[model samples]
Target: MKLVLSQEQRELRAAVRAFLGAASPLPKVREGYDPEVYARLSGELGLSGLIVAEEYGGAGAGFAELAVVLEETGAALLPGPFLATTFAAIALAEVPDKELLTAIAEGRIAATLAQPSIDLIADEVAGESATVTGTLAQVLSGMEADVLVSPALTGDGVIMVAVELAGEGVTRTALETLDLTRGQARVELAGARARVLGPRTEGGVGDRLAVALAAEQLGVMRAALDAIVAYAKVRVTFGRYIGSYQGVKHKLADMHCKLEQAESIVRYAAWAADESPGELPEAAALAQAYVGRACFEVARDHLLLHGGIGYTWEHDAHLFYKRAKTDEVLLGPPRVHRARLAESLGL
Candidate 1:
């Protein structure tokens, strides 16, 4: 239904926006803030253990609040691993396993979704805990994470499990990526000791995270579109603003439409997450499919709109491009979401 934010939610957004503005503005991203430093900042801002129960030293807000934090985080394009860490915290919250939740809530433990580029299957979780054998590439928050949330082939199907990053059988190798501003690591987790968090909540946790990710993508698109539009008005060509050009205006118009649609889907998905989880499988898939593609295209258009100067590392457009691509592959690829969307509707 009504996807508008309540006054409380709006206030929350404003507070978060202001806080992040001072603490994590553009230069923080350009300088590549360290996770330890960022996480410490998050703790100072009372975001480190935000979702854990109050008794456990967290704000106890729930997914809706997390969604707000993420949207603002994306808008600032702040370079931090909070998104992945917080998302993992959500999955951790749902796990009936008390020790895991306790560890996470105390903020003494850090966890990231170890979901790899490589797919995993079920029969691997018969013993004390599930096992993930692949080298999960681009693990966000990995360098600082103590536990990792990964897909496992469990008795109930494809369930997400929490594997300790420091487990005896695990190893990590940091990778250099285009988005050097953000942290991502490749972890070699052969026979890593782990605890299966919950049933292969693929369609739930994975899908829900994807929905939030769509929100993040939407924010990225907004930023990219804003950057290009602002640049167009000021960076004149031939004594006239480039934005006055027919082709440039048309391209900007198309980008604006895409950005608006992506925003709508992102808001709808957030509402679905708050009010109706089960009814959102298709909705989440749809949002991811549309938002992910739109984000990538918008960023690409941003690059083109900037001309030769956009290719430089100094410009922020490339960061958005890399983020969109990484996000596209994060929960599942666009094709995977599209396929799920079609299958859910029996098409």
Candidate 2:
């Protein structure tokens, strides 16, 4: 229940912010949403090894560190496979295949995930290489990925498989998205090769991914809240700062409170995912519910704070706004999270 961050955590946030400021300024970020920029920075920042353990060419940091780093990454709006890659790392961490983990931790390999198909089952993951056909469109940084984690049928159930992006009969194409600042790509799988990493039968990857996506939502919540707070003070209205207005101040305060609540759940969810994977499905769904809607609301308020100018192409608020909406459906909508929460609660 402690609201304060540890000294190390605060330092981590500052260090990441400083690094992004100097290494990848907003001006540079505005230049393009190229994943390569983030990819290279991932190496320069040693982020490729973020989730991998010391035994697998990583710094051996836990998900607490992942949350911290990702919060910074979200604030900067750095477009890359960061969330997907790190989540992929979680499954890879359990992989007996040390070579694959080493490749990603060493920055020589990339792994991104796509939305699970209609056939993807939340439970029952086990067995050998499976068959998967069709395509995943709008995969974040999918084209640059060396691997893709997808759900495929394994006998009576569906499970997660790590497929080589360079596999035979696989095709990749870059895409333009609603939010141009984030890279997207289409992946066509026709007789694509696969490696079974983890299964729902053993450890439900479908739920695991929901947990990971929730962590990223927490990051987005932080960024949108911060951006709106910063905007409120500087933006002028009625011959004074809009932040001084009673209505605006109250609204911003509500956003801050909601963000704090979401942050609490985010920390707990991250802790659960790292220290107690069993509690993931419920914890993740809970966090995503508060986080998903809170971020969209905060970002929308941020856009409105800018007045008519908020609708313009020049403002960064709209960018965050768009990204927030996009991420809302990254794993599924808020309604999906709510329904999952209800199911978890057995109601």
Candidate 3:
């Protein structure tokens, strides 16, 4: 299927890019989470509600539109709980929760998926309430989230639950991370009360999250490549531009090729998430498998091209590098996606 951004989508991308460029400069992103910026992005830009239905006080857009916004946010290194909130919204939208959806759309409450590294299943479940007892090693925006959408093993099957983070038996500790722009937290849930949403079927919310993250990786790769290209044209060595060298030129070309491939895969994945549900599993896996590693390579090459300055803390190259590495492992990494792709293909 052909994937091309419509005129409206292009306009949306331009607007988001412009807004982020002005509002979320590199220094601002390094300062950590900004509530004011998050408010503007959700309230004014309506980004948090991009994929929510109109009846739920959202824009009623599809995953394709959400992909566009995420790509721009990634390029700008805009921080906060955007990804977590988006994933939570996607999960909540599947259930009949008007109040939660409305609050999420209005940016009144933030939520995230609480998948622990220790186990995918909840510690215990009795009746309608589930008890989550474990330390979630990495929770994106967990500290700021008001609610958490988690998967718990039940008598019937694994089920998704919406738990209030402020409830008793929940503790959130912010963690220092490689990418300060994207905040993370360690969450400990002990007998936390949760409202059951529904069954956790195969190829469900996880696939959607994979596609969304792939879109974000595309943004990171593109931004890193663009920055390096711009620098290559101006930075000179031995009385000649470094970009004039065949080695540097070839590296840039390879990076560009990878970026293009990643873009195509992410677009298809996003489209499949909206239109063809059956294809989502394969598409998401392929997108993550290719885009994740592609982004890391591009970001690493970008840092190398910048020479010593790229290695320094002052330069923004390091930030992108750190983000790429973090994102590589965020949702199971490239290897995991590749394995999933193979399994989906029966190979």
Q: Could you say which candidate leads in TM-score?
A: 3
Tell me which of candidates 1 and 3 scores higher on lDDT. Answer: 3
lDDT of 3 by residue, 52-138 (tens): 889989999999999999999888877889988998887776664777788889988888986533243565566556676656778
Candidate 1 backbone clash number: 4
For model 1, the stretches where C-alpha displacement exceeds 4 angstroms are 53-57, 102-107, 116-134, 151-161, 190-203
- Which candidate tops lDDT? 3
Residue 321 local lDDT, model 2: 85
Error of 1 at 54 (Å): 4.8
* Residue clash pairs of candidate 3: none
Better of 2 and 3 by lDDT: 3
Tens digits of per-residue lDDT, candidate 2, 177-196, equal 76656677888877666777
lDDT, candidate 1, 104-183, per-residue tens: 65556667775533354434666556667766667886777777876665445567677777778788887787665567
Output the better candidate (2/3) by TM-score: 3
lDDT score for candidate 3 against the true structure: 0.85
TM per model?
Answer: 0.86, 0.87, 0.94
Residue pair clashes in candidate 1: 121-153, 122-153, 158-200, 159-200
> What are the Cα lDDT values of the candidates?
0.75, 0.73, 0.85
Per-model clash counts, in order, read 4, 4, 0
Candidate 3 accuracy as TM-score: 0.94
